[model samples]
Target chain A: MQSDLKRIVSKLHSGMRIAVPVDYAGVSMALTRPMIEAGLRDLDLVCVPTGGLQVDMLVGAGCVRSVETSAVSLGEAGGAPRFNAAVKEGSIKVIDATCPAVHAGLIAAQKGSPFLPLRGLIGTDVLANRPDWKVIDNPLSDQKDPVVLIPAIHPDVAIFHAPMADRHGNVWIGRRRELAPMAYAARETYVTVDRIVEGNLLADEMTGAGVLPALYVSAVAEAPKGAWPYGLWGEYPADVDELKRYAAAARTQEGFDAYMSETAQQGEPA
Target chain B: MSNVLPREILITTIARLLEGVRHVAVGASSPMPAAGAMLRRALDENERTVRLSILGSVEHNFFTNGSCELFDSAGQGRIDAFFLGGGQIDGQANVNLVGVGDYPQVKVRWPGSFGSAYLYFVVPKVILFREEHTPRVMVEKVDFVSAPGVSDPEVYRPGGPVALLTGKGLFSFDKTRPGFTLESTHEGESLASIREATGFAFEHADSVPETPAPDAATLELLRTRVLDELEETYPAFAADWRRDLAALSVPA
Candidate 1:
């Protein structure tokens, strides 16, 4: 169904594992707001560490029960207030991992494999903390060195914003290859695009190679500036001022509520 | 009389350390290292083949495959040098990029490990850069080993800690001895102060030399071309550094 933000988020239920692309990768921050505004709780949100305003917004709205990602930080913008606060208070479960682990897990699911073998994480704390990840000796090699294997992470829903999508629903991901793996791994894929193009993206020589086939996409919503406060690659730069303000205002619960209410009134995407 | 900033000293020293590297990749939130890499790229006209892949830069980075591309390249021995930092860096060069206190839950929390664990093993010349030179930061043992500085003899590790550059001094890692040896101290920083601040034990010469200052030509390039290019990815940091350089040369 090609639905709006509210309707798309309304479909989310508590305790669902939702995967979004990393901050640098296209993230639909606008669609996530309605889920927060709806007060949906106990979500298992997954993304890379550099999630900046996107993860902080959800954590600030108290929609996340656990975060299964490599890291969560604001990067150059400074500290991630809500995420830091939640971790400090022991209110959230952090499945701390390395970047490759998260990527391997998703890729494993995409390939329909039980697990994916990774090179590192042998003597590190990442291996110690994650019991699900195991080390096995490389059977094929003459020298038996241990290799860590991570279980497949098949998220319930994969949601993100993209620069463009054609009428056929083929989303153009450009260089963001992680989105391809994410959509393949998830049970359902939902996307919000800056604009829906006329010609089929797969047919165009320039954009064809970058298209994520419509067969993987379940829903497509049109939301301009959807990855706001976070840049959408070649489109526009991040709203740094808004990000800094968010970092400050999200330090406290009351302040977060005030910030969200004010933003909600700003008439974000329908 | 000329003036110098501690941070400027760091950049110059890092550039010197990065000499002869074909490709250096600077991760996000690392302006100083990125600046050092850029400076190296600018000064040495002979090494025009040097390639810098700054994570968030539009112009500097040539990678089309996004985040995982760096890791894949590093694994194949393409990226010669990379930078890593931690909340705590231990005696053996093991780093803790995760948190401070205990596992699962800690007293102090920093960002989680994204690629440090994997890249530390693949990249040949992984420089450990930590500006803070306190016992709290340079510890006896890291609380959590995000990526070990030294691995087991059996482990198939190509990349490990080469050197550590801090605000106080620079230490070269001895792979055979499996320890850090105090190389030299930054100008105006005393050996006594470094000894007092360092939590881990390291061998030092009777007389440690002062780190060489950046020549006039290099400094000029840093203030101009380096600063201009850096502003694209690190606007606030570049602006602040430019402002600081201006303030330093001002009449008292």
Candidate 2:
């Protein structure tokens, strides 16, 4: 397990790409607002899986790089799960992160084992002969096996919201158990948890087998409503309507600064 | 049909166009698009059906069966009609959310556009849906074109967008023309209003048509069939959203 997350504050850098599940918009918003407000060099880029709630925030804050997605999601970019223009303008890059299953399938393909046995995107164009995809012969196998090879994600950092985490960086996703493969795709992982259990829990006890082990995670922060501006399952979440209002107000820089000043002090109500 | 227009009229207009549909698929993070597809089922158009799927997110609805394990909805291949969003859309409807730069050091970093660059190329009969229409949101040449639109549709390797929808009304590109052209406007909203809100040139060959209002039967069917199932499927979220809707309906 890793040490306390306060260490991360010191470790912040200028060119790191933090890949995260955008649903935990709170953790990201809390961590980012200060950077945007201060105009700091840190907190460089945010990569969201398609359909995340706070795509605009990442865009408005102006700290996003390219996003990875399947070819099927390009047309409808302005509805629910909308990917706004700021990010779409070259900041959004495409890869096949359509689902964690696709990621794992790519990893399996990279390893050159067998059929990239995956469940989702079974019928979608994620399997199309696009520039983002490559069919490579299995280097790991003696047989000349051609597998659908997806490039490794290698996120500079991956952060997620979880129900519980240990002081030792054992992150646990309680009921919401998606994105584990993404957590795996990232190079470093950080978890913001509601509770910090004293001892380590078994992998099987928690969801997705605690995809982030202490070995992989750099730090773990205790952040509630970290999924704010987004949402958390039973707990409080970012009022989506409120976010829409912010979207309206965020159109201009002056308006954005005013909004930030007003909302910065007011964290999600406890 | 009653004077009260229902969301069904619009949904059905799109649904009928889905007549030749065979294999329908959707991506993650697309609830409304998935719901629209489900609404097709609500219309009892079972034989010609589209599937639904979605990408999972942190703040999104997640009662997952397993990690990286698709929801029962997506596992059933029940995802179709992607609901994505963007800002500063271009004439060709090319989308961009990511900052313009190489991988590491981008100049003006923004939130990354998650799926559009990929999804736009594949989803059959894509509906470029948007709830907001403003000057910057709708634009001339998108400064950063992440997902290629009409200009490069033929170059794209997959099926492309069919219709573009907005709260103001509808937009489409000429099979023969270059970029996007105006098709219609919503009832009560004017061409001037739409033009003022757009970021690009308002291109229209002729006077735009008024959007057809929703019907009573469609609303009733939605409440009975679609809303009811959604309420049962997502009680907590439905309760919260219903309360919010009530608050919104309250007189200022």
Task: Assess candidate 1 and give its TM-score to the true structure.
Answer: 0.96
For model 2 the local lDDT of residue B173 reads 53
The Cα error of candidate 2 at residue A142, in Å, is 24
Q: Candidate 1, fnat value? A: 0.56
The TM-score of candidate 2 is 0.58
Query: What DockQ would candidate 2 receive versus the native complex?
Result: 0.12
lDDT of each: 0.85, 0.51
- lDDT tens digits, residue span A10-76, model 1: 7788889989777778889878777776778898988843455777788877788888877788776
Best by lDDT: 1
- lDDT value, residue B180 of candidate 1: 94
Model 1 over residues B16-127: C-alpha lDDT tens digits?
9999998999988799999999899988767467799988777888777677677778878899999998889998999998788876677767878878888888889999
Where is the poorest 10-residue window by lDDT in model 2 chain B? B150-159
